[model samples]
Structures are given as C-alpha cells and as structure tokens.
Target: MRKKLKEKISEALSSVLPITVIVLLLSFTLAPMPIGTLLLFLLGAAMLIVGMGFFSLGADMAMMPIGEQMGRKLGGRWKLIAVAVICFLIGAMVTIAEPDLQVLARQVPAVPDAVIILAVAAGVGVFLVVSMLRTRFNLPLGPTLIALYTGVFLLSIFVPNAFLAVAFDSGGVTTGPITVPFLMALGTGMASIKGRDEDNFGMVALCSVGPILAVMLLGLCYQSTEVSYTPFAIPSVFDSQDVGAQFLQGLPDYMKEVALGLLPIILFFAVFQLASIRLKRRAVIKIIVGIGYTYVGLVLFLTGANIGFMPAGYYLGTTLAALPQYWMLVPIGMVVGYFIVAAEPAVHVLNRQVEDVTSGAIPQKAIGLALSIGVAVSIGLAMLRVCLGIPIYYLLVPGYAVALLLTRCVPRIFTAIAFDSGGVASGPMTATFLLPLTMGACEALGRDILTDAFGVVAMVAMTPLITIQLLGLIYQRKIRRTRDVTQAEEREIEFVDEIIDYNEEVEL
Candidate 1:
C-alpha cells in the first residue's frame, strides 16, 4: 500500500509540476500577478499534487470496489424497474454532491443554484438508467448517441442563444471527480454480467448527455430573466501569516463541501453492505481507510484549486488579454491546456481505467497524448472565440456532427472511451480554471460574457471526441495490417513448409 501511494504521488507530482511551471513562467513574463496571488497559487499547486496522490489511491481502494460490488449485486435477480430506480437515486445523489457542479452553479445566474442542481441531477439520473439498460439489453452505442445528440441539438433550438453555453457545459461538469470512479465502476460491473464486458465504456458519455438536455430545457423556461455574472474575489495577502490565514480560512468550507460530497456514496455503500454483498471484515476496513484518504484529499484539492489556481487563471486571462496582441491567448492557452488535462483528477481516473480495460493495448501515455492534443486545440479555439465573438453553435454543431459521424467509423470501444473522455476531460480543471480564464479574457475584451465566456468547457469536451476517435482509426488500420494469424492459417502454412522440406530432403 505504501509503495503504491508513493508511485501514485510521484505520478501526480510529474503531472502537476509542468502546469505549475507554466503558470509561474506566465506570471513572471506575460502576466505578472500580485505577490499574494502567486503565493496562493504555489500553495495550491503543492496541495493539488498531494491531494491527487491520495485521491487516486483512495479511488482504487474504495470507490471502484463499492461500485463494482453494487453493480454485481444489481446484475443478479433485480427487476428492471428496481434497477432503474436504484440507478436514478445513485446518479442524482452523486451529482448533487459533485463540487464541480456546485462551482459551475455558483457562476451561472439563469436559474437558482438549487434549481440548476436539481435539474442537472435529474438529468444525470435518467441517463444513468438509460446507460445501464442499454448495457443490459446489449444495444449498440453508436446509433443511440447519434439519436440522442440529434435530439439535444433540436432542443437547443428552443433554448435562448445567450444561455446556450451554460446548458452544454452542464454536461461536462456533471461527471466530475466524485461521479467518475463510481459511475465507471458501475458500468464495468454492469458489463461484467455473464462476462460480456466488451461494452463498458459509455456510461459517463450517456450521463453527460442528460445534463445538456436538462439544462437546455431549463434555459428555455428561465429565459425570462437576463443572465448575470458575479466576479470572484482575488485574495489579499501582505505577509506569510496572511498566506497561512488564507488557507486556514478557506479550509473549513471545502472540508464541509467535500464531506457532504462523499457522504452519499459512503452511506449508500454502507447500506448496501449491510443489506447485500457483505464482504469480509478486512476488505471493509480497507475501504473505510480509502474513504478517509478520499475525503482529506478532496478537501485539500478544492481549497488549492478554488483559492489558489482560480485567481491565477483569472489574473492571467485579464492581464494578457488587455495587450494589443490579445490573440496570443491562443498559443499560451494551448500551452497551458496541454498540461492542464494531466492535472484533472478525474482525467487520471479515466486514463488509468482505459489502460486497465484494454489490458495495456492502449497505454496511458497514448491516451494522455490524445487527450492533450484534443484539449490544446480546444483551448486555442476557445481563445479564438474569446478574441472574436464566435457563436457556440458555430463550433458545437459541426463538432458534434463530426463526433457522431466518427462513431460509425471507429471500433465500439474507442467510440465509448472517446465520448467518455470528452466528459472526463472537462472536469474540475476546466470548470475552475479554463472557464474563469476564458471568461476573464472575454470580460476584458468587452464581449458578451454569457455567449463568449460560457462555452470553453463545451469546447474542451468536444475535441476529445474527434482526437481519440482519430487515434482509434489509426489503431484499427495498424491492427489490420499486422493482425495475428489464426491457428488454422498457421497450421496450413506449417504443412506447406513441411511438404517443401520433405521434397527437398528426398531430392537430396
């Protein structure tokens, strides 16, 4: 256990260190920030590394096991209605507790936070059930995504133009850290039924869709009021004590939120344990310890991200954006975007699972690179939207059109992983940092904040669908060229070789 934690932390440090360096370089060169802000960011970066380490270990120990066990139990003898109800409850519960969703909710003014939360939660709940049912019935994922996404686009027509970005972003943030491991495990467990585990990759993708549809419908109903934005305050620190105090003051709020965020899943696991799938005592204790690690890690992570990185991202966006060469935001943002995806907690979870599911056929580094390229392109495009007022639909309609079209072209697993990657990639990092970064630039440029600033997460989510599918296309062609011969083919070739050998020997 200690060795694994060390490895996890080391991996996290390497992943996080680059972004820290990038932020520092920008601060010193292009976007000088206040001393206090830099100090806070440094502190946040440190905490994020430690927190990611703990959280990764904890997820392996706790969340993954609980989800798998629950899934296995559900795969047996449960009625379809019962399964649906359970899925809905779990989906809504985890989503309501997602800190990323809460952060996103606090930023939007189109609806009350409670309304947005409930609406998005309900959306996730319904789609989670759909995901499981599809797995149970052995349905093809491609056409389903095409049909659902088509419906989502049709619903967008009814949504007001100004509020469209928020609707799409809801889909991205719904599968944040708290939701990813569990929902993914649940999907794996569902797919494990009868050993038909080939199609376990699309639960997060389907769940991601629910929130967009839900939020779009909400946008139409709530369009009567103009959307509003409240600027997040930058901290003031004059001394070391003030830096310590800032962290001290911020700790309790995140502690409460993280605690609340984890409670539902923990409690559900407890109930499920008491009722069914009761494991050995040692296993339960290990899970409890993992849960502890998860809680502490999350609290620290949220504090660092919101208190530290948030201000830095906002400051950079505002400062650099005011320059005459504001379009430079594209390259700088792309550079930042490359490493930022590595820092996303849920993204780590997704990459690790993909490697495990594919049995090392798809290495972590490959998926990481594909995701990095996708996010880099996304950041560049998002900056373009910020620099010039591009409509969200201009990018989204064609992006989804291409993504859905690629589903027919790639292997089913790649399509699943690609769609799921879109959601996982737009996690806390995108919500807390990139969203603020783009919005800050948009605000500085005097563009409409709602239209320009709001769609960065949607952009972040969209590109991976294409990039990963492209990777799959490459993998498919490579395999076709170098496929392993079947036993019959090998035997026939050997027989021909033996016949040649016999003729040669007899002639000699």
Candidate 2:
C-alpha cells in the first residue's frame, strides 16, 4: 500500500512538474504576474494534480474492479436490471463527481448545478443502458450513434445560444478520469460475456453520445443568460518570498477543496469494497493506504497547477500571441496538446485496457499516435477559431459528420474505444493547462474567449472519434486481406496434392 501510494504521488509530481516549470518560466519572462498570483496558481496546480492522482488510485483500487466484477457476475436472469441500475448509478456518480460539470454549471446563470448535474446524469444513465443493450444483442454502434446525435443537433437548434458551448462542453467534461476507467471496465466486462471484442470496446463511444444529446436538450430546456469570462490578470512576482508566501497561504484552501472532491468517490469505493469486492481485511487496508497516496498526490498536483502553472500558461499564450511571429502559436499549441494528453492519468488506463482487450493487436503506441494527431488538429482548429472568431458550429458540424460516418465503416470495437478516447483525451490537463493557455492567447489576440477558448475541450473530444475509427477501418481491411490470402493458400495446397496423387497412380 505504501509503495502504491508512493508511486501515485511520484507519478503526479513527475507529470505535473514539467508544466509547472514551463509555467514558471513563462510567468517570469512573459506575463511577469505578481508573485502572489504566481504562487496561488502553483498551489492550485499542485492540488489539481494530487487530487487526480488520489482519485485515480481510488478508481483503480475500488471502482474499476467492482464494476468489472459486477458486470461479469450479473446473470442472464437479471442482466437487464443489473445493467440499468449499474449504468444509471455509475453515470450519475460520475456526472456528479465531474469538476468540469461544476465549472459549466457556474457558467450557466439560469440552470442550477443540481438541476444540470441530475439532468446530465440521467441522460448518461439512459444512454449507458442503451449501450449495454446494444452490446448484449449485437446492435450496430454506428447507426445508433448517428440516430442519437441527429436528435442532439435537432434539439440544439432550439436551445438558447448562451447555453450552446457550455452544453457541448458538458458532454466532453462528464467523461473525466474517475468516470472513464470504471465505466470502460464495466463496458468491457459486459461485452466480454458475449465474447466479442467489437462489442466490448464500443460501449464508451455510445455512452459519449448520450451526454451530447443530454446537454443539448438541456440547452433547450433552460434559457441561460449570455456567457462571459474574465481573463487571468498578470500578477507581480518580485521575489522568492512572495512566491513562497502565496503558495503557503493558498495550501489549506486547496487541501480542503481537493479533500471535498475526493470524499464522495472514496465513499463510493468504500461502499463497493464492503459490499462487492470482498477483498481480505489486509488487502482492503492496503487499498486504503493507496487511497492516501492518491490524496497526497492530488493535493500536490492541484496546488502546482492552479498557483504556478495556470498563470504561467495564460501569460505564455498572451506573450506568444503578442509576438510578431504569431504563427508560433500553432506549433506550440500542438506540442502542448500532444504532451498534455499523454499526461492525463486516465489515458494510461485507457491505453492499457485497449492493449489488453485487443491482445496487443491495438498497440498503446497506435492509440497514442491517434490521440496525438486528434489533439493536434483540435488545437490547431481552436487557434484558427480564435483568430477568425468563427462560430464553433462551423467546425463541429463537419467534425461530427466525419466522426459519425467513420463509425459505420470502422469495426464495432474500434468505434467504442474511439468514442471513449475522445472523452479520456480531454481530461483534467486540457481543462487546467490547455484551456488557460488558449484563453490567454485569445485574450492577447483580442478574440472572444467564450467563442474560441471555451470550445477546445469539445474539439479535443471530437477528433479522436474520427482518427481512431480510421485506424479501425485500416485494421478491418487488413483482416480481410489476411483471410483471403489464407484461403487462397489452402486451395493451392489442395490442388497440388490432387496432382501428385494422380501422377503417382499412373507411375504405379
């Protein structure tokens, strides 16, 4: 347990530290924020990172195994009821736990957080059950997604303009680190009963569609006020003492905040531990220790991000855009997107699970490459959106069209992983680091952050759906070619044997 906890803390620090250094350099060199503000940002970043680490630990030690076991054990007699209940509970738990949802809720003036959270959670639960049914009966994921998303778009037309972006964002944000691993595991376990890889892997994609429709429907149901955001103001950092004091002062606040966020997830895990997993007392104790490490790691990460990294990111974007070499923004943005996705803790679990389910046929390297390309394109497009002040709808419409079309062509398993990939790829780092960086750049460029910066997460979530499905198509074609060659070889061997037998008989 101690070792596991240490590892989580180590991972959190290592992943977060590079961004912190980058932020510090940018803070001092570019925006030169006040020392107080710089420290606050650093503190927040640490807490965010540490919180993620602990949350991930809890998910693994408790949530994931429990979900998988539940899926595996549920009998045919109760499959429907078991699936519906689990999906609804997991979806609701995840939606409620999502920090991003909370952020979006605050942005919407008319819809209360409780209302939006419950509504979105309900949407996820319903869709999740639908997904489970699709896998159970061998339903095609592509057509189902197309039909569902069509409804989402139609409803989007009626939703208040103010709620459009936030609504879209809600879809992406609901599939965060804690929610993703457990949900994917649950889907895989459910799919495994059928012993079909395609069925197992595609559940994430189907589940992802549910939130988009849910949030869009929400937009129509709630008439939100026009959205607005204040850019992060540069802080003055004159000396080391100022940075130290700022971090010191903000530490307790973040500690409390992260603890609050982690409690529910932990409690959920505990309930599962007592009721489901039934690990020995010693094993449970070890898991408890792992949870503690996770907590420490999260605190460190969040504090670092909010205090040191975020301000620096904002300043860097502001300064870079201020440069005569504006094109520099694209390359830098792409690079950050590429690395940031790798650092999203949930991504590790996703990649590993993909590899395991595919028997190493779908290498983690492939998923990484696909995710990188998707993120790069998303960021590049986001920068363009910021520069042009283009409506997000222009890009999203084409993007979803391409994604949905690919869903039909790709193998079913790929579709599931791909859709889930979109959500996993856009996890916490994108929110804390990439969003702020883009927002700062947009601010410096005099662009509307709401129209531009706000949509990066949605874009990040969309592109993976297309890219991974493309990979799936390639895999499908390869399988066909291999099968054809094998058949031809067998025929040739049979023909040769007949000729040899006839020739030997004539000689005799």
Candidate 3:
C-alpha cells in the first residue's frame, strides 16, 4: 500500500508540474495576475497533486474492480433486457454523479441545472444500452459512429444556435474522471465475456455520444434566447490567512457535493454486492477504504480547482486579451493547452488503460504526447475563434467530417482509442479551467459567451480524433515497413539456402 501510494504521488507530481510551471510563467510575464490569485493558484496546485495521487490509487483499488465485476456478471446473464436495463441505469447514475458534468451544468444559463443534468444522464443511459448491444451483436463501430454523429448534426440543425456548442460540450464532460474508470473497466469486463480484443474499447466513445444527442434534443424542446454566463469571481485575499480562509470556506461545500455524488454509486455497489458480486470480506473492506479515498481526493481536487485555479484562469485570459498584441492569446493558449491536459486525472487513467490493453504496443508516453498536441491545436483554434469571432460550426463540421473520413484509413483500435481519447482529454480541468479561461477571453474580446466560449470542451474532444488516428496512420506505416523488411530477409535466406543445396548436390 505504501509503495502504491508513493508511486501515485510521484506520477501525480510529474503530471501536474508542467502545467504549474506554465501557469506560473504566465503569471510572472505576459499575463501578470494578482499576487493573491497567484498564491491561491500555487496552493491549488499542491492540492491537485495530492488529490490526483489519492484518486488514482483509489480508482485502481475500488472503481476498476467494481465496474469490471458488475460488467462481467451482467454480461454473462442470459436475459438481454435485464442486462440492458441495468447498464442503462448504471450509465445514467454515474453520469449524474460526474463532477465535470456538474461544473458544466452550472455554467449554462439557458437550461436549468437539473433539466440539463437529467437530459445528459438520459443520453448516457440510452447510449450505454446501444454500446452493450453493439458489443453483444458485434456491430461495426465506425459505421455506428458515422450514423450517430450524422443524427447529431441533423439535430443540431433544428436546435437553437446557442445550444450547439453546449450540446457537444455535454458529451465531453459526461465521460470524466468518475465515469471513465468505471465505464472502461465495465467495457473490459464485458469484452472479456465475449473473448474479443476489439470489444474492450469504444464503450466510452459510444457513451460520449449519448449526452450530445440528448442535450441537442433537449435544446429543441426548450429553446431559450436568454443565454448568459456568470464569470469566475476572483477571490480577494489580503494575506495568507485570507487565502487559507477562502479554500477552507469552499471545502465543505465541495465535500458535501462530492459526498452526494458518490452516495448513489456506493449504494448501487452495495445492492450489487448483495445481489450478485458476493466479493470476499477482505475485498469489500478494501473497496470501502478506496471509496473513502476517492471521496476525499475528489473533494480536495474540486475545491482547489473551483476555488483557486478557475479564477486564476479567468483572470489570466482577461489580462492577456487586454494586451495591445491580443493575438498573443493564440500562442499563449496553445502552450497552456498543451500542458493543461496533463493535469486531467482521467487522462492518466485512459492512457494507462490504452497501454495495458495494447500490452505496451501503444506506450503511455505516445498517448500522452498525442493528446497534448491535439489539445494544444484545439485550444489554439478555440482562441482563434474567440479573437476573430468565428462560428463554431465552421470548425466543428469539417473537423467531425474529417474524423469520420479517417476512420476508414486507420486501424479499428486506433479509431476506438482516438474517440475515447477525445472524451478522456476533456476532463474536469478542461471544464473548470480552460472553459473559464475561454469565457474570460471571450468577454474581453466582446464576443458572446454562449456562441464563442461554450465550445472549448468540444474542441478538446474533437482534435484527438484526428491526432490519434494520425498516430495510427504512422503506426500502421511502421508496422508495414517492419513486415516488409522481415519478408525480404526471409526471401534472401531462402535464396541462399537454395544455392547452398545446389552446391551440395554438385559436390556429392
């Protein structure tokens, strides 16, 4: 246990340090922030590192096992209806508990929080069913995605323009820290039952689609023109004590929210344990401990992010945009985006999973680099949109269309990884930090928040589809080159052997 804790802490520090350095550099340079804000951000960074360490450890200990066992047991059941219903319920329940989704829900003003939350949850539920069916029936994922996204775009056409970015952002946020570990493990568990390699992936990818469709449909039903965004309020702190007080004040509220979010999952697991799992007493005790760790870690993480980092991001964006060379926002955002993705806890989970599933064929380093580049480009583009006032659809339509087209050229596993990476890349940090940053910049540039600032998550989600698949194309090329060399070597050896045999015959 001590070893695992140490390892997680080390990983968390490494993951978080790059972004911390980047933010500090910005604060000291082009985007000079208030000293109080800087202090708060530094404190928040500490909490984030520790929180991520505990959360990752707890997820390994508890969330993965719970999800895998549930999926395995449920997948084996003969009753399709029962399996579908249970999967749907689990999907909806976990999504409702997602911290990232909650953050996004609070930001969008046109729809009530509950209405958007329920709608997004329902989307997850329905799509989870579709994912299960796809796995069971061996449906082609590429085509299904094409069809689903086609429908998404079709629906977008009818929905209010303001809701377009929000709808897509809903999809990205739903598959966050809490949702990824469980859902990925569940997919793995179900795939194990099927004994197919490809089945394990694309669960998160499919599940992501649910919220987009659901939120878009909701937009059509409840169109509101009064879309407004509340900017992040910079906390005033005169001294260290005030800074401490700020975090302390926010801590309890987040603790309560995290507890409420986790309660449903714990209760569901308990019922599952009683009904089906019957895990050993020792195992159950371990999971309970893990749950406690997860709860504490999440509270700290959310408190630090919302109370500390968010305001810093907002302030930074506004400060940078107000500069004479406001175009610097693009390169500055790109650099931040590159490093910021490393701060996403769920991203680490997804990278580890991809590595394990591929037996290290796809290294975690490669995944990390690919995602970082993708997010960098996404954020750069997002800033460009905010600076120049470009419609999101102008970017999104071509982006998705290109992503769908690439599905034909790349290996299936890359497609799954790419799409899944999209969801994983846009975790809590994106919602809490980048979205606020974009909103601040948008406000500074005198652009509409709903139309301009709303799509950062979606942009984060979209670019990985192209980048990872591009990685896939490169990977495929390497494989082919290796194969060709091996084949040529074999042919040369055969030729040599034939010549030797003829000489032997002549000598004889």
The TM-score leader among the candidates is: 3
RMSD to native, candidate 3: 1.4
**Strongest candidate by lDDT:** 1
What tens-digit string does per-residue lDDT give for candidate 1 at 1-508? 8899999899889999999999999888888889988998899999999999999999999989998899888766799999899999999999999877876677567688899899889999999999988888889899999999999999888787766787788888778888888888888888888565456689999999988988788788877445666766677787778988999998999998888889999988998899988999999999999999888778878888888888889889999899989999999999999999999988888888889888899999989999999999999999999898889899999999999999998999999999999988998888778888987898889988888988899999999999999999999998876665565688899999999999999999
Between candidates 1 and 3, the one scoring higher on TM-score is 3
Q: After superposition, how far is residue 165 of candidate 1 from its true place, in Å?
A: 0.3
Output the TM-score of candidate 3.
0.97
> Residue 97 in candidate 2 has what lDDT?
65
Lowest summed lDDT across 10 adjacent residues in model 2 is found at: 70-79
TM-score, per-candidate, Cα-based: 0.95, 0.86, 0.97
| Residue 212 Cα positional deviation in candidate 3, in Å, after optimal superposition | 1.1
Relative to the unseen true structure, what is the C-alpha lDDT of residue 495 in candidate 2, on a scale of 0 to 100?
99
Off by over 4 Å in 1: 107-110, 484-508
* Clashes by residue pair, model 3: none
RMSD of each: 2.2, 3.6, 1.4
Q: What ranges in model 3 sit over 4 Å off? A: 106-112
